[model samples]
Target chain A: MTAAAGTARAVWRRPPLIRNPRLRWAIYGGSLVYLVLAFASVDVNWTRVYEGLDRGLRFVEGFLVPDFVSRWGDIAQGMQESLTMTVTATVVGIMVSVPIGIGAARNIAPLPIYLACRGIIALSRSFQEIIIAILFVAMFGFGPFAGFLTLSFATIGFLAKLLAEDIEDIDEAQAEAIRSTGAGWWQVVNYGIQPQVMPRLIGLSLYRLDINFRESSVIGIVGAGGIGATLNTAMDRYEYDSAAAILILIIVIVMLAEYGSSIIRQRVQ
Target chain B: MLRLQNLTKTYRTGDRALNGVSLTVEPGQVVGLIGPSGAGKSTLIRCINRLVEPSSGQVTLGDTALTGLGHGSLRRARRRIGMIFQEYALVERLTVMENVLSGRLGYVGFWRSFFRKFPPDAVSKAYALLDRVGLSDHVDKRADALSGGQRQRVGIARALAQDPDLLLVDEPTASLDPKTSRQIMRLIVEICDERGLPAIINIHDVALAQSFVRRIIGLKSGEVVFDGAPNELTDAVLTRIYGEEDWSATIRPVDEESDDQVDDPDAEAEHHGPAEVLDRERMAGLS
Candidate 1:
């Protein structure tokens, strides 16, 4: 071929993630075939889908015209239990998380303490809150106490893991400056790392407070106690309106929590 | 005197940053160290405080051997040494006064420092140092709000607040403008003279180091290639330390000319963080 024709025919494209062209094309083709096979395997019954849609429309209607008066007593009691569990669990979780978070931060902690604390955080995070709630409910015989424990345990995983990551990412130069002054370990953390991470930690704690409140509502349905238990009872009786009322209350409270937390977070920053 | 006898450091990655380098700095002597990047200047300075821990060697400050100290005593010995960083590593969220007072954390108890209640002398000393560095009015301002030169001034105040015997300054002016760089160098050297304190300042700017410091030590590939008075740093010596490169522009007689007008407050307030150091090279060349 002439030089101009050869040059015109040549083309360049960005490199593929998998360097081997055959392997990359094969991978793409395999995923497309797998998607087709998976969809083919799915058994969707149109009859059941239509029934579920009809039932869902009733749910929407119940939500639109919620019955507040009939379920007001149970709703009030359940909300009170939920708020109490959320606040106490958050306070206790934060109190416990500070030490564990410090231990888990590799930059600050020794290897043994770091490993142990990381293991605790990983274990707490592995299982979903609902699973923990079920386990706690079984162990404690179905009460708000079990719900409280589940929420607190879940909070530890969430708060401590985030706090540890924040600590690890702090400015080493600032820490070095502090250490050069001959400060003790506690003093180094206070003078150097704490100031850098405090604003974020405060924001996280506020965020976690709302998360615990939300989770408390969920853990209650598994024989633990809160608004979810009230919700479960109403749902079992086919009292959609009462269930809608409980859901509305939970949403309103959660929105308020989110709004309040954001304001506080903005101020702290 | 601060002494490093055969100080060596080989990173875990098998990179030998410093190789059997040794030096002594006498009391009240200010030594400026110059080298190419990765030539072990930072490692040498950190080794004295055992901050970067010399892989195999000894660092002794006065009667105590720093390398052998346990946690408690290492801290005790460390309190006597002050460190200044290239980035002016102030606790950004803290008030300037708090950053300065943090230098006395070693002397005060945990609760006392935790509550920010320093010893009366340390507090007064911090105030005096802040005044000396011309940051007296900005003490209550957060460190992050100040200019780079101002933050470095706080770094100096913090170092002095320790009542330290020796100061290990790592690239003190690497992040500053030419004018501000000169100011900080003058301030550091002046303070060293006033306190009769020994210091090892690792500076990369050949001309700037030559202008301010009396003694100079050059490092090349982890060894001391040149150690002499600044005036003795000729073209051949520059080539030896930094490898063969045009040295005429870098090693001329000190300009001794009037500096450019002071930078505006807004310009000063802009961050001269490490990321901005590249832009400064052209400015350094012009100056």
Candidate 2:
């Protein structure tokens, strides 16, 4: 009886099993299945990968001595064009999106207008900027104008949707209280909606400007006129070193634009 | 100066929030509407401002028939009436000064109000009102930063800045502690008396209403059960208003006895496992 009592006491004193065994077993089985599938699907061989790595290293070594001395003029011109396209498109996009976004916000605008604006934004957002650029290239016949239009449409879709959401999430009581004070609809929007949304809109616009800069570089690949056009030409000619140089310049330009816009966004907000 | 005749409101859910309610408030009188929850006190107050449009009624403010006016005209008429809310309802992101200045928005242009460029007189009045509410040092603080009582003070300051002839307050003390509730009631009563502006307040506490208001309007199931001076608010009248004797029985003993009787140590020991029981018991003791 004494031994039985001691055993019972020891069993009772043990902590409860808080961790579920079924969940642990399921996770273990899932990982095992994933590993088996990954290994089965891969055609990876150590010898081929090792040989490919050497060739890549040798090709990169050739570009280590960048020959920017002869190509400086071309590089500067391309950079200028890229910066202008990005800035112009972003500015125009933000300027146009303010009204469109306000109209799309159902809390602010009438139902019909909100639906129409939302549909436009949706259409613009559904396609990639390159696809839109291709369409513009067809209509306007291949230039920076095509790229600008594409970027503007894409930015409007993204920025307007974000701005509309910001407007919707504002303190509604402020608007109601302003209305109660006999303020007109315009007055209520101006006082109640504008203050709350302005900072967020500015932040979103700056962030989009940075994204547009990156997108502008690639949109030029379809004869839209930027560094991307030159980069494509270099790649087609098998001038890998020149392609590497252009890639480096594009990275630098994007980084600079991102830094500048981030500073402005912080200050404004 | 404000009158409601046969005011009625029925929701789409088939709930009659206010059923044929009518009352009148003369200038300079503080009228208190007392009722249990869902007794249409809030609906009646909101209907006065046409915030909740009465289904069918005659609502007159001064010489104007409020119920008959068009939206634009009604909006213009609303400027003369100031409203204070239970949650304070000052825009949380805005500074105390800006929230107070918002009361003058009706008189200012859209561009001016947008930029927060209130008239010099309005700005001065906002400062004075803030000072009156003892929130002078907190003029720059955001509305969300302030405590419940301080936010209510800001609400009063905002309403007063409107220079209104009539004030509508809805459950101004419902969210406050007993001490803060009395303070807010005192401020409302003092403001109404000093400005000679008639005010209507919706309140749940009968004792608070009786202590602060000159006239008490009692509502039961969305209809007025009693309307008279605070002195006429008796146990029999309360029973009719609440439709139960439980509240009177609970309240009368507390009112009669100056001290709480539920402070027995043995009873308190039984409430040791959860503090919620003790907290509720303490609240019941206060009431």
Candidate 3:
């Protein structure tokens, strides 16, 4: 076989990659079986799906002819609550997370502090914002304060994790240069870590602010106070038009938040 | 005066980077450390500033004992010892002025520096240093935007900003072109001279080191094998330090012919014959 291949190489030759037909076939077959099992487990009810489609068409209609005039007062108040909660939570969360993030970064922090910060980040991130809001509402007796705390926790989890990762990836040589100058630990962070991660942190904070605003609207479902409560009430009373108005306002605000943050992110970068 | 006594460093991986090395530097003296890669040149420089902590030994800068000092005092001692890196370790996102001002981080409080409110005197000194480094107009430019040579200039200015008593330079010209390497070495020597600051420059190019430094210290296998003036760094001494490779090629000046061209056009125009013959004989003996 060697002599034949050597003699025939000038005509044509296959590259040295060996094909594995059995493994390829097994992968294809396994994917097909998993697809079938996933569909089987869905348990989608066709009759309910038809009813949902009908309801969805009605929702779309209501969305177009939203009852903005009648529920304007409630909608305006709820929006104000969400806006205040988002801003307050985001600012406080950022203030808290900067140090925590620094502590969490393995490259910068001591081992014990790094572990503790990691634990805090994990705990905050473990529960959904709604679950945390329910807990806070139960403890604090239902208000925008609960929503504020919930969003702040969520913000800390997200911002700290991302910022810490960014800090870990920064150029260590620059940090060493700072340290060699006899700068203290905080001085090293302020000069070394902060400059490298500032643009990313600002971008992340803006993004977290947008996220907290969205989450604030939803946390009101657990009596934490925002547009979600108004939305729930309008839905229960079958005031679809008023519900549509609240949703429209939320969509508009989120869109504005997204647009503004992107502009700021571009400038920062 | 700066002194390193019985300095030794063994990494966690058990690689002995520096082994019982001892040295001293007098004020305003520029000492060149030359060795093959991994012969502990960088480890020795870092040991001086305690950037890479020595496993055992004492590093005395003036009256302070740098070894075994706690975090706070180590930082205080580090402030007086300036360090330059091969990569020109400037914070890339910061402006040239900010990077230079960072040398005063040890002097300023966190709040004051955080708000970028360095003392007016520090600011003026940073400006003067930038001008001295010939980067006055590029003060507001970000460090990453500068050329390699320009960035290294900023690195030198930042080190000088500390008003350090001693400078620790690690492979200062390792990443530069021949012309740029000479320029950087010249700048370091001039600055060290003017400030009366002693400097230890870890260098790769032996000829450049000979041109700049007053004394040369050659290390082999984490030990100082040769310590004397540049004139004493003969081909045989280089072979002793770097081992049985092409020492003649390594020691022969790469571009000193250009230096003579710039000064005297006819001094050594026809003097390459004897040097070439000696180099060939050395190559034959080594083989």
Assign candidate 3 its CAPRI class. acceptable
RMSD of each: 5.4, 7.6, 7.6
Pairs clashing in candidate 2? none
Least well predicted 10-residue stretch by lDDT in candidate 2 chain B: B266-275
Question: Which lDDT tens digits does candidate 3 get at residues B1-287?
Answer: 99989998787657787899999999788999987777777778877777777889889988888888887888888889888888799999999999999999999888898899999999999999999999999999999999889999999999988989999997777667666777888899998888899999988677677777879999987899999988687778988887765555445353454442222223212112222322222122211
Q: Model 1 compared with the native: what TM-score?
A: 0.92
Better-scoring candidate (DockQ), 1 or 2: 1
DockQ of each: 0.56, 0.31, 0.35
Model 1 chain B weakest 10-residue run by lDDT: B278-287
How well does candidate 1 reproduce the true complex, by DockQ? 0.56
Report RMSD for candidate 1: 5.4
Question: What is the per-residue lDDT of model 2 for residues B1-287, given as tens digits with 9 covering 90 to 100?
Answer: 99999998776556787788888899899999987677777778778777666778888999999998998888878888899886677777778998888888788887888777888999999999999999999999988899999999999988888888899998787777667877898999999999999999988777777667879899988899999987687778888887655443223242443323322223222211222322222122211
Off by over 4 Å in 1: A1-12, B254-287
Q: Candidate 2: DockQ?
A: 0.31
lDDT of 2 at B232: 82
Per-residue lDDT of A123-178 in model 1, one digit per residue for the tens?
99999999999999889988799999998998899999999999988877788788
**Top TM-score hit:** 1
